[model samples]
Target: MTLSDASSERTRVYVLQSRQPLTTDPAHAFPADRYDVVVVTDGTAQEVLREDVQAGPVTVVRAARDEWDSVVTSMPPDAVEIVTNDEYCVAACARLRDVVGLPRRHPTNVDGYLDKVVMKCHLAAAGVPVPQAVALDPVVVAARDTAERAVSTLGLPVVAKPRREANSRGVEMLEDAGAVQAWLARHDGEPGWELEAFVSGDLGHVNAIVRDGRVEPVQAGRYLGPLLGVGEGRALGGWTVPAGSEWAARAHALNRAVVDVLGTDGDFVVHTEFVARPDGRLVVLETAARAPGAGVSELALVHAGVQLEIANLRLQAGLPVPVPEPSGRQACWLWLPVPPGRRWDAARDGARAAELGVDVRVRQVGREGNDGASAAVGASVVLVNDAPGGLARTVDAVLNEPWFRAHAV
Candidate 1:
């Protein structure tokens, strides 16, 4: 599984991206002078020209919607692989892989991960425990009686969400038929709305590296509160539970089951979440075939000594998977709230954050003119502590502070 055994000294890789600037870090995934990498971005070349490109002998192709065929036609015919780390970019990556004859998840089948209705159906067919769900198409969502019918069919207190969105966008709980109708009325004609029976349980997520059709090195964590239930401006965070613990074992098993059912191939990261019921049963919430985003990888590195991006690259490059040692330190990552016009100084806030037991800090505060109601607007704070409740208590105390109010703009 060494680099020499994986592939030849000269290889080609193409990366698909939506808008984020592409970097050259993937060069390290291979041997020195081994890879000729090309990054295909949905943005224009002028857009990413100012970015810091970290890797060389690397080419960046800014692809417009209609120019994808032309871009692929221009690539070196022997491209070994194509990859992407985004949920929205999966299909593009898959298409590129297929065009280049590289191994990847089937392009047509990616809807099993992007579309909630498709995902739940696959889970249900595989005998996986999923919340009862019904899909509402554009026609159904636009009708006046849609929500009433949905409540009649799916029952009350159901969660309604867009089938194709990420980051919990347009996800809300409807307590009654009226609320359902109101929600549908506001979202009329939008496609892919799914009404799912609410499952009350402990919310948790398992992020794992799956390779050779198996799941391993799984990490489990708990959300500070209901992730999708939070209002527009609310902040939420998660921390890693030490590996090989009781819950971690169970989560690993569940993650394996999910990958097995999905028939995922080769090496990829899976973000699977579940709800552990009070009666001791677990229900599959949803799963995505991508690395956990929003500093979860940083939490993993701090607590488990694994850099997910590097591992993912190595795996995709046909190299050995680096086994990470568990650091046995508790870690928590928080998306703190900030006002639209307010300026946040992480250096000053680091001292305040330290008082709450965040000894290790990685803070990124949003800039001005950003949407304050968006969780992406705040600082992403990573804290490390030895005590079991240290990170949790710190997060709670920080959330209780006046400046952390979710209702503020």
Candidate 2:
């Protein structure tokens, strides 16, 4: 084919990345022969690499987050596809599509996906069960009656969180009115805050792929505890719910309902988290229009044949995604945070993991003395097993025996 023919045939994809892409091999994800990929980054994340740019079919462009609009506008007005797994870039990608005169490919309810308050409202409107919430803007937050009204409406022990942040950032549980007032005092001028009635239950998530507006359920998993408890002397871990199990079925049903109400008119991956209340009620917590963080994607790869990040990228590039099938195996991912004043002991941890089995994969190791909030994760663990209950047993051993070892700096 001539250059003109090849260029015309190849799909032009603009991947807005905030962090490292999930796939280790970018070439494989966006093949040179099929895609003309331009990776736009804010330089805040270490996503695009020298080798990726040097290789064929990929071009890297650096633009500060604030300048993304201008950068995209200055580009050639040729038709292009927008793709991003970054939660912060979801709306930006959607808006940029209009700027480039490309048809929208994201969920029509983009605001619902980005803002927690909006999301709950949308779900509740569709008769989907969600936590009772009160949106607090700057004006409402400043009023003296705001805290009292919120506490009265949602009752005590309310969960206050930023309306748009992910990874449980700025989430706090206020057990009393005084605590709520104090929390509000700290954010007197900020916007995008919401207070919701605390739901005490087991936290779980369902991941699915949406193709041509069809919601394809992938894997449902339950977290060991709330993600907010990550830095509070709690390890973050989760295991895939066994396929065909009651828990998986309930999760899948809820996931479908969520996607349906959230306007599933496009191809993408949806990560929806819900709470399984002790009363046997499943209430939707939140949903994101992107791949989940941590090793959840890795777990999906083992549980089924789909890795969510790659699937999301493919969906955006107009490429075909794999139809996920349960592999009749189970997988789990664990994140161990290094205690304050301690550093990770990779040798001891590796040895202990080996003793457990060869299925264990140590995905990440933190730097020495990196005990800050952002760098608190000392190690990441992902493992898979075929034997019945083998995955849970291994996870128990890892937690009880504590495979993640650390040394004082």
Candidate 3:
């Protein structure tokens, strides 16, 4: 393209983010010349803005939470604009909804999707098969009744957690009523909790770029578990792509149904996890409206042949989508969330992780029991392909690792 051609293009997009998001496998720099203006919200990426890494004219505006409403509402109509899923972001999008014409999935859709309880309830009503779970409003849960509710509704084998937590924080899997009481005591004076049926099955995940109620799920990706023992809630194992099989197909169908059922009204990206019960059933376990955490942003791009950041932009702009057909490649990502409490031997485990054919990277590393998604110290991620076929073997390897075995509670 010549200089005139480059100048002739009349498209621009603004990414609302706190930082230049980290993805281990991306080659695209921030959109520069392609966009007319890039606004840095809250000045999180001010360095990027100051250095003018962006090819075009960039403006760095530092505004606080209170000032956002007045500013966003005052924006002049412009090119394609989108924002991440945050409370302030939602308000900003609402302020500029008509003028910017962002994908319908802006702040409002994001607001609804972040709350787990609402997402579950919405999916169930939308015709998806969800686990037996109860969502509570912010009413504080008494330690005593919390136990009774678990026993009465979810029964002996159950999982409990706060509705608003991420990384499975505060999640517990209890096999006996006594266990629920003990766990509830830990909460003491916290507000509300959700008790879910303790579901056991092979875990499968889905990442989709959806707009106008139509879903383009990248594919079902399966996760290997026992990765966790009793009461552990972190996802320490890696995942595989190209989930192909009768069971995987069913899981995929369930993903579509769940997304369509709890469907967001506008353009949005969703990540959901389905548990394939041993008894030939499926349960929708986890769902997120924003892009997935734990490094899946890169995994989705590499495995599914889609650029998630760009997809998020298109959906918000009401423009054409660019998700392509699969590249028939196998890829995997591990959530390197180490176990909490137990002092696991890391040296042997790191070697074992590589031996299991894992491309290992740590997402979190802190104090033992800090990343508390499980007993794990921090989050770890694994990337691989041939997801369904290779997943089981990799999981088996993870379970047998000395580091994993040492920390098993």
Candidate 4:
């Protein structure tokens, strides 16, 4: 147990958190006692990261594109940079390459998903099924015959998402041209849209870690309930993990081949969405080269038995570990249950905070729906255990509960 013994010693993994560790409880993997550096950039996730980095000295720095040069240069020359924020994604890499250069592992064509149109094209060309998609800027698409043709040809029930959006931001599901027009108006204020042929089926997902030359499944299952999107006055409702079999296996195999074809097996994590038809066909929605946001880190650890934080640590140390087997357990990352206009006072309401582990998030106040109360927020995570081929439980536990308050104060 001696700290001097390298075998038992915890590896230095910077659970680099810009917003949060994408987990309710990051302590599950890189516990403070084991992880060396837990760097929090800025925002609610940073606050949570700071709380979780208690095992060692936590460094809270306000890092920006301009500051990256001085920051990386200040750190130990060998210290590897683990990136998190999407806004500064490109800049983070550029700064790292210019400063502490070498051995930064990331997903191949990671930027493709940033553009919805590009993602569709790539998947379609690879023979990987995806929703019929087109790039539309409203007026831009209205002007171009080709773009206009896609708009006219694309069937109803289309979902328009900004190419650069995350967490369902600026995402709108439309049934006809009117909805499309309203959505296009919004897109004018944001990035161009990727209007996709929305697939109808049971919701499900697969997140895997690809290291060296292998793609290992971390969490795969159905989305028990509804997938929430952002609204004018409130933050979008997040997704809960479910136990779905039909698409899970097929998605893993499909993603495995897709990853192989893309040549991104070197060092990275992947999150792919899918639809399971009653006929047993699996359609891939889209994939991200980076780790899945929300509380996926814990799901990867508890269900897949893949220590993403540890793997990331090993990766940072230039040491790779073998992929482990998935335990087929259900796990999730849920937001605080607080409703819009409501606020979380963890100190004054200990029982409430403990009860609603995944309800509260900090962003509720920033948008149109917020009631305007400001204090940091937190989330929760659950890991299920299964015996043999059976699943632990339905994702309903994670989605439906008094622990998660659906109505905001």
**By the TM-score metric, which is better: model 1 or model 4?**
1
Prediction 1 TM-score vs. true: 0.82
Note the clash tally of each candidate: 1, 0, 31, 16
Clashing pairs in 2: none
TM-scores vs. true structure, each candidate: 0.82, 0.88, 0.70, 0.72
Greater TM-score among 3 and 4 belongs to 4
The sequence of per-residue lDDT tens digits that candidate 3 reaches over residues 1-409 is 1112134455444545443432321113223445444453774643333121224444545666565545554544453444554323544554556544433454345534556677777777766777787654454455677678768987668887677655556676788888777766766566657778877787777778777667776655666554344335455543535545565467667767766666546676777777778887887877766555544555666767775655554455555556646666665555544445543445666677667666444322322334344544343545554554564565556655655443542
Task: For residues 173-284, write the lDDT of model 1, one tens digit per residue.
Answer: 8898778878878877766778899999888888878776666664788777788533355667888887768888888788778777776675767788889889867788
Shift in Å, residue 352, candidate 1: 4.0
Off by over 4 Å in 4: 1-57, 79-91, 94-99, 137-150, 189-191, 230-246, 309-322, 332-336, 340-409
lDDT string, candidate 4, 309-354, tens digits: 5454344334544465655455544444344465434443435545
**Model 3, global lDDT:** 0.56
Lowest summed lDDT across 10 adjacent residues in model 3 is found at 21-30
In Å, residue 6's CA in model 1 sits off its true spot by 9.4
- Residue 9 miss distance in model 1 (angstroms): 3.9
Query: Which runs in model 1 stand beyond 4 Å of their true positions?
Result: 1-12, 19-37, 43-60, 105-109, 229-232, 345-347, 350-376, 387-389, 393-409
Give the candidate number with the greatest TM-score: 2
Across 1-409, the per-residue lDDT of candidate 2 in tens digits comes to 1123235466566788765453434555667776666778876434554211224444777888788877667656554567787787888888887778765678887988889988998899999999999988653365669988998899989998889888787789999999988888888878788999998899999999987878998999999787866565578988898879999999999999999988789888999999999999999999998888877887898898898887887776566778999988888888777667767556776677778774333333344565465436666677787888887787877787655656676
